[model samples]
Target: MQHDFLKNYKHKTKESRRLYSRAVKVFPGGVSHNIRYFEPYPFFVSGAKGKQLSDVDGNKYTDYWMGHWALILGHSPKVVVNALAEQAKNGILYGTVNGVSVELAETIKKLMPRAEMMRFSSTGSEATMYAIRLARARTGRRIVAKAIGGWHGFNTALMQTVNYPFEEEEGLGLVQDEGQFVESIPFNNLDASLKVLETVKDDLACIIIEPVLGGAGCVPPIDGYLQGLEEFAKKNGSLFILDEIVTGFRLSLHGAASIYGLEPDLFTLGKIAGGGMPIGILCGDKDIMSLADPVARADKESLCAIGGGTFSANPMTMTAGLLTLNFLKENKQQVYSKIDRLGRMARKGLTKLFAESGIPCQVTGEGSMFLTHFSKNVVMDATDIANSNRELLKAYHLALMANHGIFFLPTKMAALSFAHEEGDIKKLLEATKKIIIDSKLFKRFA
Candidate 1:
């Protein structure tokens, strides 16, 4: 009666109600992001530390959402928080370049060998927007071929979800996305993609993609697909832009680009790079990135199209990014290895649960990420995911949160953080098993 999930949620906090009420008046949805929105209202966080997310209503969660997959070290890891607090005390920002920003760039370049230069923006949208812009400028092309259903920032041209076809009710006809020349294609349909590209191959400036599809249900690129994309883009005289916002850092030290041995002409980064702070980055060759720094140009004049923001590389965020990267570098083996173990544990546990229940459920994801789609079959692309058992999955999501303490990304695509341990995986698996046992939909399989 008094906002369900509060008396129900174990870590309900007070700010949830206040934030929701205060936010609705200022913002349409009371939240700036889609994933944060819920049926009645969303919980407001008082703070987070380690793997715990404390809601304004005093609800403490095990935090599988992990700040939407950015807190690689988990919640307020002392290294990042202390860096931010210390930097905040020294002062927040100025109108000039700083040391930490340079350090963060150098650290990322070391991981992504293909990246020789970089620039930081506040959000993934800006990073991606600039990436596509750079592609167009360098190639002098008009069209950008992106994988269908891939959400690249908030750019009007790239918001379409990958692996999922547009709903007819939305009235977005198939030929093109309203006005933009964004041509969408299936992730692994090599021949189909090639054939489609042939239509406007000459006009294409870039073919941007996610190495492992994060949205459209955590779909991974099929084997040889990445290579095919690279070859195809090059042969057609187009730039390949790797959108690793979600997969960056989380996938490996090299991120998705290095893990797949991808050599992209342009790269966009976000998510974990910010260390839970708002940050976005676009990087590539020295010649290309020089467009952003006018002094590096032959003309010696900067242009607005080069991408710059006032609070783009703010001090506190840069400090957090620097600290997070330092921790990631020093503990590379431990952190990556530990997160991999957690992924394996969750994947194995869920596979066992779904198999025993005779329910066609599947867990697909990589790195410190996993998406539990209610289908016991292999999902290669969007169509397979679209027909997944959403009803059962949503019910399972609610059950896991309500009956048990495990929290997940409400949209089915879940992220794992370092704070999670074997015990955390076990607890989630145990809860999921019970939810399966209690679900009539799960029983229907039997």
Candidate 2:
């Protein structure tokens, strides 16, 4: 059978293809970010409104990627946009401490009671990097333990065993032996994690984990997994740092820390916390965060030396975040209710469609984040996902985008926003059914 999906995609996205031809001359892989690049080329989005994206080719898609899972309220949310606009008129950057920054921090503290003190950074990577440094400085240890597939950031220190094969190192230009400072343990496996922690107990500075394995397919931790990890970390004299970059506001206003009743020693947040702007935050107990304070510094050697960038807590991001947080705080029940319903709808619909079509697959996730795997077994961890048929999964994802106009991350992870309604969920399910039948994936699996 002819692959009409690929043909239709190429024809519909002719303009994006032409642009990619020019972009390749400037960018390494014709894309600024690696994830944005796929087999044929990604569609250049002209604009976005709510949960819909209009590509340059005038093809409108129900955007499940949602700005890399940051736009919980959907793209260009009116509240955030209006706040940003008002802030821009006053001034964009002040290069000094501002009132809005304090307000934003206060809002975070109110939402996350454990955030006694907080410091701002420019990106999620910087927040995680600083959190790791603080843990090392406070504990006077050299090693950090992370889950096998957890993606903290691009920082070299936490770059080992992320998304790549578990046996091989994922760091590219990391300093020699830097990977040794970081150890990987199986996620959601208390016994395996404890074993690794026992081995690295002496040198372990921190155990950083994402409550839900965001990039590895939104796999939630087993019942007491997070709490167990925290206990193990404490027992080993290591701090627990929760990376809530993707789940901060997307999962709950207070993040996974609140949902799981986890009291991490340090928390790194970004994504929705930025209100669609570039921002990162590291918040924790006052004593731990004080190590980064210039005024509290006893001496140069005593401080952790966490640096801030030029636009670390600019007014624009502060205003936008403040508005976003306030909106979430006021309309918590309504927003979360809609997103949770949408998530259940999508998962149930996909599972039924795939099963009826005789395709062996499993949908794994919690709340608003989910991903489809081409396997019948339950996905408990990253290894389970890595063992599946990745090529076929990628083909299915491509088919969804090409033929059905349902955009998802090429890794198959998807999310729902408050903007998604019952009708949108129905549309997505119908499109998915059509794609499965048209792509003939069921025949291959059968």
Candidate 3:
């Protein structure tokens, strides 16, 4: 059955097969990013619009991956595209400070007031890397703590214990001493996490974590888990940082901090903030953020020394981000209400469907994102996620793509965009039901 599905995928994506053949000659694993390459090669996208992705082979699938969960308004919303076209006519990169960048910053500050000051970077990795640096500088401490399965980005310093088998070395090329000052704690287990923090409390610089764990699994933190960590950091004289790159604007306009009542000393934002363009923002209190002020410090020794790259705050990104935020701000009620409602429907429908078929599974996520864990046990952390039936989940996602026109990035989390509606959810449910009935793979899971 697995072989049959692979054959079906190959038959549908012949052009993609040819393109991937050429890609491997230049790129590692036939792709720039590791996740983009999956079993039997990934389909090359020709274009995308709204909630649909059209591949080079003319196969269209309702895009649940949603540009790594960045496109909340969906592919090419006219509001952003039209304004971006005009902005492009003026300039894309000035390589210097611009007014539009200031406007965008002001807009973000107005929306999320905790961001008294901010600096823009081209990627979330840069934002998170800088966040830790600022914490170390502020407290004059050395150690940083992160959740076991939390993924901040590819930054070398925070790369410890990101994948499964949390105790093992992440991979080659990372120096042994690089992770010396970093500590990992289990997610959702506040007592165990606090015990680990106690060991390095004196030298702890910061506690950086994702409010909702992405990449590792779409697991939401249990109640009071985040708040307890924050309280510990506060008492231990360490800065508390929230890596909201995935949960920032997606959960709500105010970000997850507001929803969870967290007052982090420093926080990072990316993904949806970019508005389908590339952007990364590090926001914090005025006093802490001012450490990066070159003019105020006057010397390299006195400053934190963090800023954006050449592409940071380019006019194109600033324009698109500003437009997207503006649209969301104006229609905030409509946008959040619709997307959250859809998220509830997806979770509930899937839970009931799986139960009826005698399949043991748990659907995990908050707001508009979700993932299925093929396990009877409750999933609360990365260890539980690692123990789940990942192979079966991958096969299920593959079947959805090959036999049905639904798209999920294999076993990764799926996010519903504002462009998706009730009809789209119905279609997805229908497809899942058909796959459950027709595929012989479900028998083993049952």
Candidate 4:
């Protein structure tokens, strides 16, 4: 069947147009989050099952983005659905400790050994924010060190002043975007980052890093980089905190820490721990996490300055988490093996398509999460992602959505899940190949 990329394709996303128009009246950009809004509007999803996502417009997609990389079991897994229903019947929020909450903590501690004790929150941002604060309280310092494209959350501390074009930034008399209090250093450049750490040594409380940079693309670190960081943080008297929000259970039961062979004093978990529920956890040694304990902090009237929220570890999410944790623990190895196969296939297929067109591209990922990077070569850090062809990446995402229902995160990130099979992987590869052929992006890069 003959189709149109610009003409007929635009009509298919009509519901997005209508929704965005209505959304803008109440919200700033027809969407709550900045990234959720794309082009005329975003294609809203009505439902998801296994590896498929059905948009409000009735188009079905083989989704690799996996709900922004949250659903490792994929959308509406039977186990999660049953667990959630049972938990719901019991109660949603108890506003206090419960059996399920303790269960999740114990499971996390067992899997991620460095996490001796754990606290909870409802989002990755909160977990990381509190971790940073905890590090500061432990060390009595302020400055934080992180990778260039590191995304702990959209929190101002980590999100600000990253991925900016320094050359253009100079002319604008600003760093990049609207953010404050961040010391942006180039990624994968150990010397450059070390210099920043050295300069801020005195004031630095901790160095928080994502073992495998996820949002910047699933780019792994160079040899000895994570270890060197541990050495540096130790020498400087700062704590080492690993942001495992995305990598935690998704990469492995032990996550990047175990895989990379490093031990962070404190760690965080986000994507899979909640078990399709909304929750975040910061786990670390008993001494460190105790900072949040009212008794440990002392000066009861010291303004409740530490981090603890009423709904931080509600009962329902904990119940779902327990169910998911048990399932994952029992089948962790098998799940990773299957997903890794899919990851390799999709990455290889996408590379071959780009090769045919002579497009300078690379696929970086771990386990099942993959990203199609438009660059001269494979990158080891966020700097390459910042300097690469974002416009082409955007076009690729849009084309894949149109040419075939092979959905990915609009942000050039592909977060695969356990539900994806070989067929889904093939569909995504075929769809990607079509986009490369149709867009002629290779020539544009040439």
Per-model TM-score versus the true fold: 0.91, 0.97, 0.99, 0.92
Q: Name model 2 segments beyond 4 Å from true.
A: none
Judging by lDDT, tell me the better candidate of 1 and 3: 3
TM-score-best of 2 and 4? 2
Query: Model 3, range 8-41, lDDT digits (tens) per residue?
Result: 9999999999999999999988998888888889
What lDDT is reached at residue 13 by model 2? 97
TM-score, candidate 3, is 0.99
Per-model C-alpha RMSD: 3.2, 1.4, 0.8, 3.2
C-alpha root-mean-square deviation, candidate 3:
0.8
| Candidate 1 all-Cα RMSD | 3.2
The lDDT per prediction is 0.77, 0.87, 0.93, 0.77
User: Can you write out model 4's per-residue Cα lDDT over 1-446, one digit (the tens) per residue?
Assistant: 12355344468878866766788999987777766777546788889898888988888888877767878888888887887788788888788778777778888888877788888888889888888878887888877777777778866556644455532322333445433334555567778888888888888888899888887767877878888888899888899898889888877878888988888889988878887788888888788877677765677643224444777777767866777788888887878898888888888988788777788888888777788788896677777777778777776777777767766666557877888788877777677766666666445684
Greater TM-score among 1 and 2 belongs to 2
Clashes (N, CA, C under 3 Å) per candidate? 22, 0, 0, 0
Which parts of model 1 are misplaced by more than 4 Å? 1-22, 161-164, 167-180, 296-304, 439-441
Model 1: how far residue 78 lies from native, Å: 0.5
